[model samples]
Target: MSPGYLPFKDALDLPAFFCENCGFWQRHFTRPDSCPLCIDSRHVMPQRGWHFHTVEEARDRYPCHWAEVEPGVWRFFNDPIDGIGSSGYLIQTAAGNLAFEGCGVYSEDALALIATLGGVQVLAASHPHSYGAIWQLQDRFDPELALHPGDLSWSGALCVSWPFDDVLEPLPGLSLHLTAGHFDGHTVLYDRGRHILFCGDCLKFELDPADARRATTISAHKAFVRGIPLTPAELRRYRDVFAALDFTQTWTPFEQAANSGRREALTLIDTMMATRPHAYPVPLETL
Candidate 1:
């Protein structure tokens, strides 16, 4: 008798690999030595050293799970800190399902759950850091991966089909806009109908997460983990883009899915502003 489950490599017949340090997936016939993104300023080398894994290893290592963020939005993630720790989201619409933030691990079980949700028609992410095994997701679902040209060099795998710039509306009521704070070509997705902003790594969520629902205690950074801060001008770009978006709640990879505070998020750039020439943006003094 044959086994019920298909092997990882056999099931998803795609030439893709992932970095154990960052969890960003790339396509290659055979595993290449040294990941470029890991050595970049933003990611840097992990203290444990370079750890690479095949798609099969990723599957065996982590157990994938998901939860409903809203009626049409769902969060798919892998528990336990395997890599940088990221979650992918699925926004179901009549136009088609959009997989926001590529999920890291791919399994038969993961596919089954997605099938029940109308299947994915697109895969997109704000920046490289939040991108999991996107190449795998694209191969499995046969959806166009919406990526910006600014960060194309960071892609370990060449799976991008829909290269958009500035702004794009791939699906009905869903718009992708450039934020470009944490990483160039960093984009945020706005669900016009749902009024939620999927603001990837552009904003860092504080550890405590007191309210979880409100977008307080969040900070913008050039590199949050490395203490790198974005310049005042960069923050200005953030302000301009976010102010134009008509979102009530914000979703970030640094934090779990929640209905974030509207006013709190909209005014985040304002609150982070202060006297210039400081190491980081200082809160303004109330005179």
Candidate 2:
């Protein structure tokens, strides 16, 4: 613990605690003895050792800021302060704005921008790692923050009120669907009208072959994904899960958007399974 660090007991009532080594906030509950995100190889741990930081210290070190990446959508990023380099977004809709992704950084400028665009009505994270400085945002904005029950332990005290079901329709065209891949609780936000899916890391945009050079590698699927390695049966199940969706494009935690539609997305999944037959073999029934 550092000088500004608040003991986990003190932060038990807060939404999350910052793991200095992991450089991200984990929802606090009983002051976790260790960070779940870091201990898991998916996120990787810090070299030095484990340490904790207060939300205040993180905000002071790295102030939150934003850039409008698309119509009615703002992208937020900060490096030096936000050590994990996670990016979040503010999506404006007819009903209200949705803060997607939690970066443990808040700034007055961000507040002003939200005020100007209409304050966020709901808050969410793509996965455990993006659960940034949510407490700070919640404290300042007072929005209905939604956390998946599967990931609740990570969201320490911040008074998690809204737990999501398998499917949640916060706005008219906006729906959040729980899709397992990276984590059992991983979710994706679907914009029905636009046919755009905010898939976090569960489904990622892959580079287009048209844009690839001779050095470009090709694959059946065109999405970048990371998580616990899946067994062939598990991978096929996941493919079936995503294949049922009716979406034209997918946006991930990273900036790129995969214009490939549901067919392409499914192809990518099948291709991934084929390439790693030993690890992800197709079942005989399906064959």
Candidate 3:
């Protein structure tokens, strides 16, 4: 069986709501135009996504908890409102453990938890915006940094940084690919042993338990609505880059896991490429 889903209330103090139209839940807010997911516009609106484990309660919930999703694969959800934003993960390998993405806050307890496992050897972030507490993690583990060269400017004043080239062989079978969609240096990790792809925010998790058995794909629609840095043309190019990967299951740090068990990653890439461009305020009521 796959991992089960839990509400944000059980995990964090954040408000959540379920969208009847898409069957996705988002955060509840006084502003109708607020988007809790992308945290941008009302067109995308915030829907309730699966809540993972967290630490603390009330205003004290600055740091969140981590979970072991699959053997050797662990995920950490950071508390957003506290200003320590985005989720990250730790993957155990024969050499040592590797951490992907940065969290809002890194505590001694969290560092100890990672050290107790096997100790981290490499720290990587998919994009600059997701570079939560990378500097702190690096100071703790002092591991090799993995990031896209295109986003080097984003890592301002960081003493240690490395460019993500073709494929990185941090371990025997694990490879890190710089997909370059959501950001110039966005990355995804492919574990040959598990055939799982850790896509750091390049894709959003669309939750539908009833269709969990089927392959799931993300929509560029949200990106379109938010007026993100990427244009439709640029997005299409990024989609093409993601099309080259071979992954069975896709996991996002804070959302539901997608079963790309059968379909190729190219299928979703093609879908996004073919969709027609449109303006925001997409009448979510109609979608």
Candidate 4:
């Protein structure tokens, strides 16, 4: 089935409403609108839940792990399952800091690392599936939550409160582009200074070094998987979107050897897009 398209740019003019029950936010279109969380009967909704957490709680819950990607750019991984490392990033931008792809489960150690780096000023995700602990990060840092307009509908009630956008210049050295591959709203972060890309699930891992350029079968990382219903044609469109991006390095949220291997990572993604079994076949005209 074809996925629904959200007019995210249009929703920007709408007013923000919050739900007392679930602490989620939504757009107030009418005098008596229902709360997205509890669907409250009243029209007036609260706004406290958008980022519900004290500074201390946020610091204690979310821990950060750092990796020197190049020079000034660093990638922070949020270890979700304790031992199994998942993907998350902390880029030191001229505009303070930016976090790409957050983990749902975090620890105090992670939070401390984030704090040491002067805290996160903007929280963004590659796609809906990667939005594991975005609400938590927003609450802790109170940064603008930048998301791809294509995936805005996935935000649901939370979309009402946070500021959404198609593209944003979070920092002078950083820019995020919408690259629909794994999900329609999937995005990739580009670091101009270091030429590094933080790609969540748009690309898969190539286990074999010799066959690194070939697409291989692998299970989707839970933090980067989405439930969006996609047709084969849509998948092809997504692949096209990602192929257009000019990137030097691609990083995942895990401790995979592929993260540091740029050429291998790009080759794996290229093979997957060109030869993978599609859920729906692309039209010859489009190809």
Reference-based TM-score of each model:
0.86, 0.76, 0.66, 0.57
Better model by TM-score: candidate 3 vs candidate 4 = 3
Q: Residues 1-287, candidate 3, lDDT per residue (tens digit)?
A: 11223343233223433222111223234212422334423234334533322222321445457777777877666544433256777888887777887655566777788889977787776665456655656656767777778767555424334565756766677778776656666677777777777766655545555764232334433343365434566557555555665667776544535454214334444544577443222211222
The order of the candidates by lDDT, greatest first, is: 1, 2, 3, 4
Q: Give candidate 1's TM-score.
A: 0.86
At residue 267, candidate 1 shows an lDDT of 55
Model 1: ten consecutive residues of lowest lDDT:
278-287
- Once fitted onto the true fold, the runs of candidate 4 whose alpha carbons sit more than 4 angstroms away are 1-85, 156-166, 207-244, 255-287
User: Could you tell me the lDDT of residue 78 within candidate 2?
Assistant: 64
Model 2 root mean square deviation, Cα atoms:
7.3
How many clashing residue pairs are found in candidate 3? Answer: 6
1-287 in candidate 1: lDDT tens per residue? Answer: 11123344343454667788888776666786767778888776877776777878788887788888689888888875466778888999998999988667857788788988878888889888878866666666778778898888876464567888799999989999998877888999989988888988766554335665543355567886677877888888888888887776678875653544345554556655764312243221221
**Model 4 C-alpha lDDT per residue in residues 128-149, reported as the tens digit of each score:** 5455445555556666677776
What is the Cα root-mean-square deviation between model 3 and the actual structure?
Answer: 11.5
- What lDDT score belongs to each candidate, Candidate 1 first? 0.73, 0.63, 0.55, 0.51
The lDDT, on a scale of 0 to 1, for candidate 2 is: 0.63
lDDT at 143 for candidate 3? Answer: 76
Tens digit of per-residue lDDT, candidate 2, span 1-287 = 01223344455454555777555665555345677777775666667777766656666777666777667878776657534566677888999888887655766777777788998788887667666766666777778877677777766645465778787877678777776556667777777777767776654333445652111111221112223455566567556656767887666655435344566556656766777622222222232
**Lowest summed-lDDT stretch of 10 residues in model 3?**
18-27
C-alpha positional error of residue 264 in candidate 4 after TM-score superposition, expressed in Å: 5.9
Ten consecutive residues with minimal summed lDDT in candidate 4? 278-287
